[model samples]
Target chain A: MVEAHSKIISFASYIPENYVPIDDFAAPADMPSKLDLNRITGLEGHRRSKENEGTLELALQAATKCIERSKVDVADIDLVINCAVGSLCSELRSKLSPSLANLIAEKLGIKGAECFDVSNACSGMVTSLMIADSMIKTGQINYALIVAGEHITALVDEARTNNLWFKSKALASLTLGDGSGAYLIGKSELPNQLVFSEPFTLARFNKLCVGEASKNRPGPMMRTKAAQLQQGVMGNLGEFFIRSMKYMDLDWEAIDHVYSHPTSPRAVKKGAGIAENTVGKIKRLHNESQDIANTASTSHCMLLEKSVQLNQLKSGESVILVSFGSGVAMLAMHFYLPEGIEQWS
Target chain B: MVVVRAWKSSSEKTTNLLKTICNLTQNLLSENGISFDDIGVIIHAGVYRRNFRTEPAFATHIQGDLKLKCGPVTQESNHCFSFDVSDGSCSPYVALNVASHMLRIKPEKYCLITIGDERPNKQSNWPYQPITCVMLVALEGAGYQLTGTNFDSSAFDSSTYVEMIFDSAKSANVIGESSSAAQINSDNSKFSGDTNWLSGRHIHAFLSQFTEGTTNTHEIIDQSGKTVTATWV
Candidate 1:
């Protein structure tokens, strides 16, 4: 009914109540300055969902908050999509029916909406956004609920049992935490447009990072070639950023905020810095990801939610959201706050 | 509008699956006179390995392996966004629905879906053993039309295909074929005892309606113990 761009009507994010201070990490005694872990990874503490908490609960919690704040009638939600890294149902026996999206919609009491899940590793949320954006711009549905609940801490906890340091090659999975995020996107006019959303596949380096469950492990485990991943991100970050900004007709100065989806590793943080430098000075930086750690698919949305909570965004200001993940793929999108709209938590 | 072009592959390793997916997708596009530049998005659907490989989203490899290098004519616009839709056999159906809306959205001219997977070794309800199959579904206007789709969410049935369908008769109109051309559908229906029924039978059966394949349908009882026929045409 409005402009073709999908304007975010509401945002909500949640980190589990259980807190895991970096000091609590099961690092070896000689694990080289446990206190410096925060300095190295830009994380002081992170949250981890308890055993009783399933991925679906994390998603439901976040979605509840989003729908409450969105104030939109449940019947009006035309789509529900889950872009999480892992399955919400821990036990995916044989049946794959009743998708996560449908489950979420049912929980939220939103019927008659198309439902599905799109998994794209860390960049899944935005990728889902791109998909919803396409559908919305085409007049398929007005309101699309996109959410992701990640228990990446499961990967870290798995490593902690034995050889975590050796397996991750020294402090991998340090910045990962448990969290979920939700966004309600709808059509809006020009000044409130969702500018450019692009995802480019760089699969040559897909092997650098992978998530899987081994024969002995029942949950997701991440094995990464940390060095190689950093090298790849850094080598391509600057060039891609400049070209993207130029293509979007945006100046680094015009962007009121840069929500760089940091992966929580020191090398990645450095690469992020290099990425920012290549784009000149970002007007304001949303780096809460350091404290929250990396939440995989939900990281970018978490960053945006935190910015809204802190009132870092304003109406009509330019913002850039960037995500790079397991697919060795990168999604960059530009958007501005709608007129007269205030940040909502 | 429907399954204008299709390809199927079967393999054990993820690498082979990706290879098969890439080949099948490219073949479909080329056969349809579609270029890499014409596609704005690629939707991939399938489960990870038996254990569920979560990271490095497989679509990345599938997209990367395509090697869509920029041509001299257009360097800026050739890039297409690719992502994965994971849920099991139901993923391709959902991906196609998402693609339908996306294609109708201007700027997205074509949608390519690549699906393939092998049955996990330990699943008890698997009707077919060591089954792996791949299919490339490309949809564009003025082609075969996807009438609609339905899923028996009541439960998962190994012997039945009941998710998405292309009913030749249900479609409002047919381009150069008979009113009943080919209809392909998938769902977790009852898994008939036939080994061939588990993998790519829907594709073959649907194609048989128009081409040179045999038509075979099986009726198997579902989790509810009700007999439901899994058909191909």
Candidate 2:
């Protein structure tokens, strides 16, 4: 049996320098303005990449910063995985997962590290962490690098073109943002900070959300509201929480913090209800910055970074990161803070 | 189970082809029961340019057309073609795996669509091979089966059979290009002088090994609407 003695060696995140206030971008005129964005989403502002910058660049920046903070060399990396949700191309044939790997290899001068991409929407980072942990435990890799970057603004239909949810879920567009986050995981003698407890999937509620019209057959369309609500409400959050707790052999009251995918205040509230928010320990962010909304695979990673940066977690404290995406996939994992890492002053 | 409709490709240039493909794909999905929003995730694989140019334009095109709220598109690289050549097995499988991971969807609830086009480049001296522009759609519906197995041919002496086909394709290009040049010179008969005598001799030698009733013959329909037949002999 493989045991996980894995911990996040270091983490880094990058948001573009350009700031896009909610009012500057084209949105519903009647919708709340910048003042309301700060009040609602708890976001004073969100970062937007300057023109001509792409997802790979954002990833590179975050990865480099992560390597620097982790005090590890890129050449030491045994594997590199991109958990990002956006690409520079529109055609299925032109997607850039492997190419990004090649670029990272060339830049880091790592000769033989296995590189690839993974997706699971908002939960992508945690899912990637699990895979990296497994690989490390199985001896498939020693040092793993996971990066996620999303440019949701490029994909949003500001025209409210075809989606009815755009009217009802206009808040989604406002809450989304563009950014990137990276993590380095490896075997260590130190006690693990991010202890991956278990992974439970509820795929039966798959039709919750959709985007990027198919290029072969259809023109464009959005996901049905029925699937979305089912995934949000009647879906498997309760089971996920129960299974995770069972795997960790802990009760709901034991968790000290919760970092969700930041879908919306409503989704977060409903998910919290699954565990009955028993300790009132659930904390949320990005309720205002819609630019990053449904950033798919990158949301969880980004949220985790923010939570850490905000000093919301402390040494020995256990936190739960729950993620859900359009496939209605939900994963709950338990992580303990590493020893010796001081809280942000 | 969702039945696959027609698989078509446009004859347009490869520039910004993703947009055109997305438009065409959307039309196809609308015609069917599926819609863009119904898609849980979009996995773009095997993206490569002739030269190194990294821009999210291809993914951006799809996002613009389909209004994808969230989904990661794969980076561009020559390996993109590996997804297709691997048949409907490997790349799509990887895409499904990643999509399930990212979209948090059940593997059974989503559909995987792959589209690609290889445009001819005229600058090279080699004869132009017709580019294959194919679009494949596989859904997570029930009552479907794929029956096939892949094994390494290197373990058998029959490996030479596959090598010969590749050699033939290369030699055919040379012969066709030289013949065209000869015809332009008004001396078509001179084209035979440029034939690769060494390769011809090797081909003949390679054929002799199969003459002892050791090889099998197979027949399949070619893309040209012809019942082409081939024998290892």
Best by DockQ: 1
Q: Each model's TM-score, in the order given?
A: 0.79, 0.56
How would you encode candidate 2's per-residue C-alpha lDDT over A1-345 as one tens digit per residue?
Answer: 445467777777775667776565534454534225434544434567656556666777778877777777766787777766544422112232122443454565555565555544555567677767766754556899988667555543332343433444434444556688887888866544555544332333333444432222212223334335445544445545555566566656756766677665555655567566432334433232244444555665566566666676566777676665544444566666654345422
| lDDT, candidate 2, B55-161, per-residue tens | 22233234445544322211110001011111110223233233323323223334434444222122213222211122233442322222121111111111111
Model 1 compared with the native: what TM-score? 0.79
Tell me the lDDT of model 1 at A145: 94
**DockQ value of candidate 2:** 0.04
lDDT of 1 by residue, B96-212 (tens): 666765454425556666665543223212333333334444454343445454433333322332221122343211111112112234343422433233223333334334422
Candidate 2 CAPRI level: incorrect
* Residue-level error in angstroms, candidate 1, position B158: 17
What are the lDDT scores of the predictions, listed in order?
A: 0.61, 0.45
Q: Model 1 Cα displacement at A216 (Å)?
A: 0.8
Worst 10 residues of 1 chain A by lDDT: A89-98
User: Where does model 2 exceed 4 Å of error?
Assistant: A1-4, A26-45, A89-94, A97-99, A157-171, A190-201, A213-227, A230-235, A277-295, A343-345, B1-233
Candidate 2 local Cα displacement, residue B51, angstroms: 24
Error at B57, model 1, angstroms: 2.0
